[model samples]
Target: MTWILVLVAIGLLSAVLLLRTRRTRQKNEPPLDKGIFPWLGHALEFGKDAAKFLTKMKDKHGDIFTVCVAGNYVTVLLDSNCYDAVLTDTKSFDLTRYSQLLMDRIFNLHLPNHDPVSERKRVNQYFNSSNLSRLCSTMRNNLQFLIASADTQNPTEWKKDTLFDFCYSLLFKAGYQTMFSTENDNTAKFTDVYEEFRRFDKILPKLARRAAARDELKFASSARKRLWELLSPNCFLTGSVTQSWMQTYLQHLKEQGLDTETQRRAMLLQLWVTQGNAGPAAFWLLGFLLTHPEALKAVKAELCSLQHLPLDKTEDTPVLNSVLKETLRLRAAALITRDVMQDKTIKLSNGQEFVLRKGDRLCIFPFLSPQMDPQIHHEPEKFKFDRFLNSDETMFCKEGLQMKYGTMPWGAGSNLCPGRDFAVCALKQVVHMILTQFDLELCDCNASMPPVDANRYGFGMLQPDGDLKVRYKLKKHN
Candidate 1:
């Protein structure tokens, strides 16, 4: 009986080891690091600070290598020159298919008709380039109404709030209104939506890795469900008439034969996608301007000259555009990923060929490459407001390199953000209004830039690690 019990224990141990086993790397493949843990692999370290961890790996393996993260082998391409090897290869690498991994494991939100790949077409149409001016007009109207007279009219008295809170809260409100406005505005309802979104946002990293604690998962689940209820079609049917981008998308979803429940879930997904990055971006842009007096002065001078230009024409305000570009270069972080749909050979521009295994993942982190590489960007740590501009006021030629993509806070390829144009308009409008319409500054003028929330490295538009105290009041002339 004792021998039988001992054999049972050994069998259990053997099964555990079998489940943890990984495949061996073949010759000519990128170097592989399985990390210290069995299944978790480099997940903990990668999550802690992806920039630091990936940088360390790049130092050891040179630009490209494979590493085991969680249970998957992810081939990371840090060479700016080699990004096209993945981004351009439609036949071998597929990002749309790769999105299913996120959907299945983390979100558990089923894509309608099981086809997010084709959903891109619908999304593109909603953000059609031809209607860009109209969308910009809608967003500008919503944004100004949110920030104007009622909140900032008291020019004599200063209002104090942390910069992050102010920026995130306002952008969420305005973006929400543009996409999902109910006829008569309800500040209380907007506040409730923003608060719940913050709750969900705080847990997204853990949730994505499937490491969220029980309570965190529960709260995130509840927050998501509540958001669906708040944005449901019945809310509009009850009397608050509207035809916003969200309404347009929902109408499209309905045409696709999705039920009301499915449409609600899709609305929640839309809310998450459309509203997440803008606020963090606005906060970082404002924070950079507040901390850098020279940049602030340059943007102010540009604003003086362009008082009559349409807010939609951000390109006309070159100084503001340059500063925003500079801020994003330093602050924005995104991970471009594709599923290895087949056993494929990727050849870098330098003629190094690596054969990727089927079932592996390919990743490109531009933030670590051209965005911060000393070769591509001098003084990469410092925010140079004119970095994207030349003395002739022509756009800087990607630091003299013949590059296809540069300063891509928005991604590339077919999946590149559809609303990217609107994003530029919205961010520029916020910065323009704040700088021109009010008296705003850091409460502690000497406060330095806060550390980035490194857990958010692969996520777009990182939030600051801590908040900066700031005060603002409406300008009397405005």
Candidate 2:
């Protein structure tokens, strides 16, 4: 009877503690949509359509709110007014934790907790202004070789092809050759490794599940193993090819005392980073130009002006530059995320402030926020080719404000992409080659713009849901 009495008292104490904890949470935390599930929370709703779901939430909950996704409360900042607070307060907010989580979950790679400052500095040097300028000719030559070898080079007849596939193939081949391998490297071997990489990339979102399932993990492991074989120092020790990015990175990893397996995984991560955005961006730029006749004509006129001029002066092609910028604004879907390292108050431009708790993630949806603001971008949904260009040959502004963070395709602040200049140069070179070498048109003029792949929202530029059919023939210049 004494033991029974003790158990009853313990149960009553537990109930009281639970109620007190709930009350404290209700008072301190931002409004969280727990959804219907016990712990799954908003995962289903978010996975179904992230952009639409977030938009609906923004309408109901204002700019700042929390959603319980997969048992974590993700605080989203959906207004450009709050961007400065996130960008400037690096001490309170950090990107490394979020990046590490993504690499661990999606890419199946584990990284060290410490900062890789030296490694980052070395990588940045490779993509500096001088190196990027020197690489322009290399990029152009690669594109030229691919185009000349393609079956579409026959000027006598138009060749039909899918835009995404064509762009992916061209960009992948050119980028891989230029950045990852030496001139004398075996093309067939590199192509095999690249194909495997694509397979792994396609299943990244499902990586956790696949890793648990034996059959799926088997395929993924085989692909990774083969990639390791190609990138390992043993294979390249005697090769005549000059050191590429991967080789240099491998040397760094060895100096840092990482095992071969870990080094290979790091190389894989680098490969994904280098190739992720450029291909999709190229596809959208060319695809949009093909579908919009007036825009195409204007850009073509701009291209004609550059006939006698040097291709090295990419900035001189104002119309093409504007088109690329506008495309980035329209299509790039990046989730700029930072972890709240300590409890802090964020001051907003609208004279409001919010308290962020430690261990919380502060996320900025670039697509749903500044990029789509009607005030910032008039007719935000429409593709205005020259929307970014001002009368004085500068970036457009909103409400007499310069709008520095209005459209962040390569992101902002310290975490901005190191390879932004290289990427832009490569993209410009690709478009230049296509415009100067090929006569291109959409096979179906009435085709609508393909839907963005919602699954890829936070993974750089979203790919089209379906490929656009296009026809091309060699352009005959007198």
* All candidates: CA RMSD (Å): 3.2, 4.7
- Measured on C-alpha atoms, candidate 1 has an lDDT of 0.79
Q: Tell me the TM-score of model 1.
A: 0.91
Q: Which residue pairs in candidate 1 collide?
A: none
What are the TM-scores, per candidate, against the unseen true structure?
A: 0.91, 0.87
**Residue pairs with clashing backbones, model 2:** none
Candidate 2 residue spans exceeding 4 A from truth: 1-30, 113-119, 151-155, 208-222, 235-242, 307-314, 391-402
Error of 2 at 25 (Å): 5.6
Q: What is the C-alpha lDDT of each candidate?
A: 0.79, 0.74
TM-score (C-alpha) between model 2 and the true structure = 0.87
The true-versus-predicted C-alpha distance at residue 14 of model 2, in Å, is 14
